[model samples]
Target: MKQLLEILGFIALVQGVAGLVHEFTDWDWGFVQRLDVLDGYEVYASVALLVLGCALLAAAESRASR
Candidate 1:
């Protein structure tokens, strides 16, 4: 279970970083098509993902230390 969370956290972190880059470079990837629903809020959504990813990563680490 912990491993799964860690994997998800990593994905989220990568996606968030990618989103930030996309915002500047406008380099569209196939996966980003799924986010069309975000409309004009992609940047904010990316930030939210980043925060959630960080939280999940922290949770995973905390669990590991226990």
Candidate 2:
């Protein structure tokens, strides 16, 4: 369970970082306009997932430590 949570957290963290970069650096969004809404949503989702995954990982780790 701990390992699973850690893996999920890592995945979410990485994905969130990617989404954040995409939101900030992607050029298409600046010009295309549609990328704005799409990337914004992706960023939000990724951030939420990241938080949830990290929480799960922490809970699992705490349980394992016990």
Candidate 3:
């Protein structure tokens, strides 16, 4: 279960990074079409995802320390 959380957190981190990249650049993630179509709100969503992923990572850290 813990490993699952770690993997999910990693995925969220990667997606957040990808979202940021989409905001600044013109990169696509294969199936996530419409990379060129976005609003300003995407940045906020990306940051939120990043924060959530970091929080999950921190949770994992505490678990590991135990």
Most lDDT-accurate candidate: 1
Residue pairs whose backbone atoms clash in candidate 1 = none
* TM-score leaderboard ranking: 1, 3, 2
lDDT of 2 at 17: 64
lDDT string for model 3 (1-66, tens) is: 667768878887888887788768968652123444545567777777788889888787778877
List model 1 lDDT by residue over 6-30, tens digit each. 9999888888878877888887742
Clashing pairs in 3: none
Candidates' RMSD to native: 1.6, 5.4, 3.3
Q: Is candidate 1 or candidate 3 better by lDDT?
A: 1
Residue 45, candidate 3: C-alpha displacement in angstroms: 0.7
Ten contiguous residues with the weakest lDDT in model 1: 27-36
lDDT over C-alpha atoms for residue 33 of model 2: 28
Per-candidate TM-scores read 0.87, 0.66, 0.77
**Backbone collision tally, model 2:** 0
Write down the TM-score for model 1: 0.87
Candidate 3 accuracy as lDDT? 0.72
Write candidate 2's Cα lDDT for 1-66 as tens digits.
Answer: 778878877776766666666667873322222444655477676577668767877877897988
